[model samples]
Target: MNKINIVLADDELLFLQGLKAILGNEEHINILFDAKDGDHLIQQLRDAKTLPEIVVTDLKMPGLNGVEVTKIIHKEFPNIKVIALTSYFSKPFILNMISIGAVAYLAKNSTPALMIKTIEEVSKKGFHYDEQVMKYVHESITNPKDKKTKSTFDANYFTKREIEVLELICKQHTTADIGEKLFISPRTVEGHRNNLLLKTEAKNVAGLVIYALKNKMVSIENDSL
Candidate 1:
């Protein structure tokens, strides 16, 4: 199997090295390099012949903070998946990262197994929302300020089946699960999903969910999702 290469960044020497050592032992995780700060990471990216699959960065750093780094990669190198390394986060801070295109945030004290699992999930699924992140996302639905009060959605554009498919997608149901619940073939489910992507103009599954949320199409407050 081709290993997942990661460029991990943090200003703290001990923590950075310790994390590198822990993740280094994993069979499929390769530490491409560890940067002391985001600026250094930028330089490393420029120097490297090949880009890594993931860039795990501290939330706060000396030269450039996680937000700035995330924006840079999201704009310049959209293919790379980013995971924010943080000891703590508020609703707005974490939400901003997600908006800026970072896949997830991992607590600094997280176990090595969870780190590996998150990296794998992000690499495969294009995003990973841990329980903490999911809880916050669910809560955001009920807050008036968090809701997109003005929607640009054209309800007439989507059929009832497409809307049901969208709600299932927002609920994080797999295609197979969705098909089983909806009593449709998996191939048919994919066709509907592609139509959702086309109509919503979303880039990926995560983008689709974000679009749905922004359009007030899916709400965790009402549905079990």
Candidate 2:
């Protein structure tokens, strides 16, 4: 079977190590590289002979966070997919990441299974997002005077799986948790989250949540976030 090549970038050494350990168990995944920050990730990408299929990254790092890393990766390797793993779920962050070309966004709370499942979906479909995240993101954003930007994730392009992912993301479930609930791998959940970020043009989880809320994609009237 063809294995999926992956790279991880995060500032927290312990967290990075823990994630690596979890991902190491997957048969189909191959971690090609790791970086302490976005700048290092870019340097590694530049120096490497082979490129990874996907990159899992933290949103906030010492220098050049996930969003910056994503911008570089998207520009240097348009074909490569990106997944943002973060603690913050704000609108600007989500929108920023989306603009930078990341395909998905997963919270640090996600589980290994969710990560795997999201990865599978992203590898196959090229995008994913938690349903709740999507709902919040859509709702938070409004007209930015750039009609072109408005048309970026105009609701029609989302698939069923992507929508589901978006919902969960908004709910703030970790990739692993979402995976377990959805009966998929954590990687797959990560992939789905990335797909949602890409579709909705969200920078981080917060941005996604705002987008969902602004667009009325997910309602906040009856439910509490």
Query: Top TM-score: which candidate number?
Result: 1
Task: Give TM per candidate.
Answer: 0.63, 0.62
- RMSD after CA superposition, every candidate: 16.8, 17.0
Candidate no. 2 TM-score: 0.62
Top candidate on lDDT is 1
**1-225: candidate 2 lDDT, tens digit per residue:** 689999999999999999899989888889998999888999999999999999998877766666666767888888889998888665555655666687788878888888888887788889887786576457556555222232223223466776777777778777887798789998888888887787677899899899887765664455444
Task: Give the C-alpha miss distance for residue 49 in model 1, angstroms.
Answer: 0.7
- For candidate 1, report its TM-score: 0.63
- For all candidates in order, the CA lDDT equals 0.82, 0.77
**Candidate 2 global lDDT:** 0.77
Summarize candidate 1's per-residue lDDT along 95-182 as a digit string, tens digits. 6677678898888888888988999998888899988888777776777654322112212347899899999999999999999999
